[model samples]
Target: MCKQSGTPLQDDLFLEETPTSSVTEKVAKPGPAVELKGSVFTLPVLRLKRSDLGAIEEALSERISQSKKFFENAPVVLDLEHLETPAEVLDFAALCSLLRTLQLVPVGVRQGSAEQQLAAVEAGLAVLRGGSVQETVAAESKDKKTGEVVKQVVVPSKALVIDQPVRSGQQIYAQGGDLIVLAPVNAGAEVIADGNIHIYAPLRGRALAGVLGDASARIIVQSMEAELVSIAGHYQIFEERLPDELFGKSAQVYLQEMALTLVPLR
Candidate 1:
């Protein structure tokens, strides 16, 4: 008769097997990778002059009522530099609350002093510095024979081209220039340009042009089926299907008189 034991015996030698260590397969966790890259973004700067909460709220309410669509969920930077005095007391928390009431999200505070910055932090706001606000200048040249220097006029950045389709959750932004997508922009994707946006294929996602407050920015799409279109700070959403003649056809979007205008791209 075989002896009974708590551990199993080895099949070949018929000897009791020693305890073995457990092995596990390594798995990669699903999370966003940490990467450092250069980027540029446009933010509406609300220049505040007075700390009067009542007046500010009233004024903001009036403005919002006029064009609630444009300001909906808009992120704005508080510019305290325009205040009468740098040391002037400001209730940042109250001001932020007032802005939220008007559908404007206050993301950061710019041009504030030490005290004001501290106040902004307490209000859960970021302190941002002035970004590059100037246009790109071309290379200067000098006349070899005349020994005279010639300055060339500044030119906007060259257009960025995307040859592949923009998948959902993908974002492409052209800073200080135009963006041209040769492939379709799937729904839930975003494409932004500071100058203009040109889509050679269907545009079913959101497209924002003139992100840096360029009023002349325009959007041209081969297929007019965008979920949302925006120029400068003006925006228009397409809740329903586009017109039969306009859908899946060439169209252009622009801003006129601080309003978004869409027309056929002829």
Candidate 2:
């Protein structure tokens, strides 16, 4: 037998007793299809000290030769603010092509001149924030009495706290903030921060603080067995076993006159 329209089924109660609006109200709504939020990641930055393409290519090749697997296919951001005003405009497309041919992905650029910015966009690269030179954006405001326009820059602060172990191949980055780890950072892991990194357990992999050139940033480890440590782009790699006294001991890493320095915490 068929039920008539507007009639409830034998096993249903809401459709018979509840009004349409009330029945609909009792049903759950569908969740949103997407969400938006802020996030950060640590990435390699290539600070351009010169505009010569030949030199840049040669240097990149040499650097990658020393650590091919480490840099292979990794996304690198070009820092253009450090580049001097060139006699000629940079060829961003060609440069990006070169990077691709060398197995490196050129994804974005930062701190570029207006011309460079346009060129980079044309070359399919994004303009990312947090460049070593893109630390601030100036907002112009007129002084009330003087009627003079003034530029103001503001910086935000934050901190990332992790309560569990950082396993191998895991990367933790605290962009524009500090990173605090309550557990061990195992081999092949990396921890980076723009401000500072505090590890309450052993650091067996890499710890790079002041990643965006904050020279005063530091790394404090409860037990240091790091394969590599860096501060403000200055780095040290332990090719051999660490000295017995320094291994498995508390230590702090910082920059001294632009050089990476590590010392005992006690």
lDDT of each: 0.84, 0.82
Error of 2 at 23 (Å): 16
lDDT for predicted candidate 2 compared with the true structure: 0.82
The most accurate candidate by lDDT is: 1
Prediction-by-prediction clash tally: 0, 0
Error of 1 at 198 (Å): 0.8
Tell me the tens digit of each residue's lDDT in model 2 across 2-109.
764555557553344545464434678899999999766556788888878889999999988876777889898898866776433588888988888889998898
lDDT of 2 at 106: 89
Question: 80, model 1: CA deviation in Å?
Answer: 5.5
Regions more than 4 Å wrong, model 2: 1-37, 86-88, 132-161, 169-177, 233-245, 264-266
- TM-score of each predicted structure versus truth: 0.62, 0.69
Residue 149 lDDT in candidate 2:
95
